[model samples]
Target: MKSLTNEVLHYTLFVMILETIEQYYTWALIAILLLNFSQRKIPNSQKKRFATIYLAALLLIFEVGVVTILTRGWPQKLAFLDLAICAALFYFFREKAWPFRFHCVNCNEKLDMNHIIGHDDNLCQKCYYEAHPEEAAKEEEKNKKLEPEQSSETLGLQDIPDTVSEIDWDIWEPREVCVITYLFENDQVLLIDKKRGLGTGLVNAPGGHIELDETAKEAAIREFKEETELDITDPIMAGRLDFQFKDSLSERAYVFFAHTYRGTPKETEEARPFWCPVSEIPYEKMWEDDQYWLPLALEGKKFEGRFIFDDQKMLDKSITVEEEDNE
Candidate 1:
């Protein structure tokens, strides 16, 4: 009888210890989650202090729980719950999951898992330091520099606002020289399916980066032949376009308007040629800026323009047009 009584008491004691441990774990999880939530809502000025306080509290709870487990003994049945609490703390306190795929805020660089610095701010390590130079005090911080990776994520053109002035264009450098050739036949225009290079899979005019010692016009004609297997002589210079991608890679493209050309449009290794009607050009399949200046160019007007892009989405643009006779 005494043996059975002792067994019952032992079982009750075990249950009590498990309940106590679970309570501690539950409280800790709730606190951690609350701290994470508050981090977003609190002002930047208070964040440092709040974070410090949160860390101190978390450590205190951790120490107390450890001591209690050591003194009162481990509850084997509650191991799962304890492990679950650890996971919750890990996920909650480290970083919030991104609602959308990652892209840098300044330069539109895609982020790998480890380099993501924050939530929607989404600045990659390089741009983050560029924007915040004061933080780059340690050599270890420079080791976090982000390198470019090939990505094919396209932005929906419909989401872009009509006129955007949000981008700061001063930091962008004009490092690349390229050309764009628009060939017209009656009311139809020739374009190509860009097979490779920067805007792969996108519909664009037949042109490419200028080779060394090549004039912009020479590059345009060369690129035209190379991509479309057609020859266009004396193609009129229509305008100049300066494109600055969100990552600050800049290109100066000399836009050419070609009304007369030789040979039939054919596919090449670089691009696949197709003719699109002027009245129904697929702006959706082309770069976002094409919709802006292409119409004016098609009307035989010369234009000079600058376009800023966040990935494939147009962020801001400005253009000046001139009469054909004036140019």
Candidate 2:
């Protein structure tokens, strides 16, 4: 009976190989089916050892299949030699496989044997490092002290996305921020020759985007210094304007009134400094909405306005201005 079973098994394997040799990958599928059958026939105590050998054998078969496809044609002698090598490797390493089970002590998570760094504590790599923060920090400091070695590893990876899809598009999206500043000396105001960036060539006050970690008030002060080299210690929040451009970009411009400042205004790459007589301010060269709201602000009124624009043309607009009756 045992001899009959052996003959039947050999005949089945031979027929499968003969049928699948011309088809290339079908032999791998047959091997997997045979492995499943073998696993069922084996006692439960021996399943793990069989599974490890099966996995290694499957990988070897897959690699040989890939090589055969790449070489375009497979010679019978080379194929037989490769099969013999795979069989020998499987036999040599079958008994030497690690026998220890690994699991995370903290989270009760099953872990791969390769991921087991310390068997005494049985902690996963991440949890082990976290539990020893002082050690982690010391290791980090040592890595930082490695100078050339550390620099070479991070030479190009810093601040660069590994793939185009990994880039966060929102960080590069268009943003509009309020840029308005009012300078006061008796009754005169400071206007800037809009030199480079947005609103270039147009007459506007000295203000710009609010930088990170700075309030709009601080931004107004910072922008004032960059554009005019003057510092405003106390800037009154005068009014606000909400503008929407045709391309869906929008901004809220916070108009500030600075009653005091230091340093003389000077020209820089971004703007040319100039004093405009309060009575003779250039309204035509300024933004259209500015003409409507400037008078209210000059009179110490608080206002809120909205403007819809197509390019430089104002498509729609509204304003509400009121004095606080400071009696």
Best by lDDT: 1
Candidate lDDT scores, in order, read: 0.66, 0.65
Residue pairs with backbone atoms closer than 3 Å in model 1 (clashes): 107-246, 107-247
Q: Could you tell me every candidate's TM-score relative to the true structure?
A: 0.47, 0.46
lDDT of 2 by residue, 1-327 (tens): 999999878656654563365355556656655645544543332444454456546555746654663356444346566667666766666543332247787766887544342233556656665454323334443554564333222334344333323333222222344548889888688999999876788899998876545666778899999998998888877877766555445555778898799888999889998998999889899888788988988887888777766557676677888545555
Could you give candidate 1's per-residue lDDT for residues 71-113 as a string of tens digits?
A: 5766544444554665566468743232223777666789864
- Clashes counted in candidate 2 amount to 0
Name the lDDT of candidate 2.
Answer: 0.65
